[model samples]
Target: MYITMEPGSELAWELYAGIDEAGRGPIVGPLIIAGVVISGKCMNKLSTLGVKDSKQLTKAQREKLIDVIYESARYIIIAEIPPHLIDAYNINMLEEDTIAYLVSRIVAVNSHLKLKEISIDAVGSSKQLAQKIREVVPKSVRVVIEEKADRKYVAVSAASIVAKVWRDRRIDALKTIYGNFGSGYPTDPNTRRWIHDMYSLDPYNPPPIIRRTWGTLKTLAPLWYKKKRQTVAGREKTQKTLADFLPKI
Candidate 1:
């Protein structure tokens, strides 16, 4: 005969988690933070979903897998930092802060779901980002930041999928109002041309969604400054020319 054990006999000790960001490389739109908590059993479910790096999956695939992963995972949290805040602080610091904030929120929401370990796709140097996270997060949680955690870790890949899907949806919504600005990354010629064209028409006017502090903004700055200088010079020259042409008074 076997003896019965107490309830909660199989309490999971170390919970594995993953965190990653999307829209960081984009010249426009907000940055998205995604965090996922996966128990050992849930890992097999993610593999069944064919969850991979967001970059590897097509838009349709990523969108489809998002719902699957959301349902399969133990917990998932996503947060966004709008372009204006990204502009207020540089991307590096903004991302660091966003990740820290997301992790804290996740812990608060899942207090019973004791998470002992977390893995993050590092935005900066792995060492630096990891240290920054530790400094901000409560002393209880242990975090490990790795360069390609999203690629190596199934949980991280799931987080990447959610972040990408959310960000792409936001971009699509913006396009409905603003038209197709392309992928929103600097590498996209269409995005660059759109920035150039918009600023050409009105230097002071920028699409409210675009990050004004980006290098693209700095590139446009010189043109606007040059035009301002030329306008001032032209006015000065016109005044001098008029004075010379005037009859002696």
Candidate 2:
């Protein structure tokens, strides 16, 4: 879907791209990263596609626009980072890694075109995240990471919609097995209650699909970490006490 930035600004860049993600806040699904590339010439066409922030579009509208985006964009790339990796790396790192991965894919696709400018919705501190990305990205490309980029940039909005639509589909499929988990945000009491109940009955073990590293998981499974921490702390304390008591030469 084509979304236009408010008129009266000169468009400086030739090949502008936007990057965004979905499933970052959701507790139960993979994080999805998406990138969309557009040129000034095609901006009107994109606007014609009814592209706006994915949140603004109805499900039907989003579904309809997905095809249009695919057909019209110079490039679109999406990457899904699974739950186990999120548990291993932590969410912030996962977000960074996912962006890095998606950006790499965009670079690969644009390699033939020799494009320079790319924009991404700020995942963390825009400056820091952009710096981290730059450290990993090749020197030839320029990266711009900005806060609320999805709303400000049409490319970012398209990426946001693509990622959100993909993640929503994943969530719906998961509901078939796990039942209703709500929106999977910690703010959703239903999601929290479902997680608490799942762990209460199972203990130490969570459903295979749940992101165990989430704050909700940590809160519900305090004893799991507490016991482990206590065991280590107790061992260190005992070692110190034993050393004090030992005779020294």
lDDT values of the candidates? 0.71, 0.69
For model 2, how does the per-residue alpha-carbon lDDT over 1-249 read when each residue is reduced to its tens digit?
112221222234466678888888777777888878776666577776678888888989988887777766777767777776555553554576566655666666555664667778876656656776786566876787887877777888888888889888888998899888888887899898887777778786667677765666667655332221122422332223222322221
- lDDT, candidate 1, equals 0.71
Model 2 gets an lDDT of 0.69
TM-score of each: 0.78, 0.75
For model 2, what is the alpha-carbon lDDT of residue 36?
81
Model 1, span 1-249: residue lDDT tens: 001111221237445678888998787887888888776676777887698889999999998998877666667777777876555554565566567666665566556766777788988556656776776556777777878889988888988998899899989999998778899987798988877887777777677778765665667543432121122422332223222332221
Runs with alpha carbons beyond 4 Å of true place in candidate 2 = 1-14, 114-116, 135-142, 218-249
